[model samples]
Target: MDTPSSSPYGTYVIAVRGFVAPFEIGVYAHEHGRRQRLRIDLRLTVRRTAPRFTDDVATVLSYEGLVAALETLSEGPHIQLLESLADRIGDLCLSDPRVVEAEVSIEKPHVFPQIDAAGVTIAYRR
Candidate 1:
């Protein structure tokens, strides 16, 4: 039998993926698309005890909260660069008490003039 003190490595990672947002991202007039879709994937490192011991969703960071924050930011002004967006998302993720780190990826599909897919990825930790 394993006691709580002697349990296996303990930590929780929650992932929020496929978040689509529209932005005016480009460098030139002709390069502009109707609306650029940004897909953001977030991985959050959280404390393991809250959900495991208490079994209460409120005791841990809510994925919905994270998504809402991202959505709110996405509705703002046009982001000229995906790197900036990724950084902001990462910062937001780490703002939660339960989150120890975050990995953010923002992708702009069909943005490139010639390429099929083009995007940017970024990572951050607390």
Candidate 2:
């Protein structure tokens, strides 16, 4: 088995995509006082030392942990821009010592009727 710490590239990827929810985010005067649909996509490249067969959850990174981190951010103060949000998330992902890189993408789907979505994607590396 390919463990998180022992990958062919000396790294492994964890991805969370299409995580959609409603959040209070925007800078427009009309964007306040209401929640808007938001989508978050994340990919984390983590460093690994070796592959081991272990049953412990602490042995590897968890997607639930990532979602919880994102949820914590969402519950905090409103964000004005997707870029800031993506940056913040990137930082959060890098907080883990095992994570060497993070790619964060945040989108606002209802920004315009004609457009499918508007968003920003950012990458962070340690």
Candidate 3:
């Protein structure tokens, strides 16, 4: 599964899964200037900066900060593709020095009738 416990680069993991938010993205004419729900899944392998984990928030990545950044990004300038969205997410995750690797996936679930969703997955390592 390539988890933090299995990977030599990190000691723990922080993840956001099944996060859905309204986003302005897509290439088709019908999608222009429109908002749609995007399902986001992210995983980050992080290393401990302290000798022992403590109650201090500084000891680990701030979950609130990550979620706030993501929500702000969703409300920011329009993006054209799911790949771009996923890549941006990867960049956000990799910004934290503790994060050794990041995997981001974005899906547009209601775009088509036949399929559940259309999306892209991206991975980045530091």
TM-score of each: 0.79, 0.86, 0.88
Best by lDDT: 3
Task: Judging by lDDT, tell me the better candidate of 2 and 3.
Answer: 3
lDDT of 1: 0.72
List the global CA lDDT of all models. 0.72, 0.82, 0.83
How well does candidate 1 match the true structure, expressed as C-alpha RMSD? 5.0
Residue 91 error for model 2, in Å? 1.0
- Model 2 Cα lDDT, one tens digit per residue, 1-126: 754344554777889998877788899988777778789999998886466537776777889998888777777777788888888888889889889788998888857899998888898987
lDDT for each residue of candidate 3 in 1-126, tens digit (9 for 90 to 100): 654334443367788888888999988888889889999988888886556778988777877787888899989888888988888888889888778888898889967799999888888987
- List residue ranges in candidate 2 displaced over 4 A: 1-9, 53-55
lDDT of 1 by residue, 39-126 (tens): 7788887756533557677776789988789878967776667787778778788777556678887777776578766777777765
lDDT measured at residue 76 in model 2 versus the true structure, 0 to 100: 70
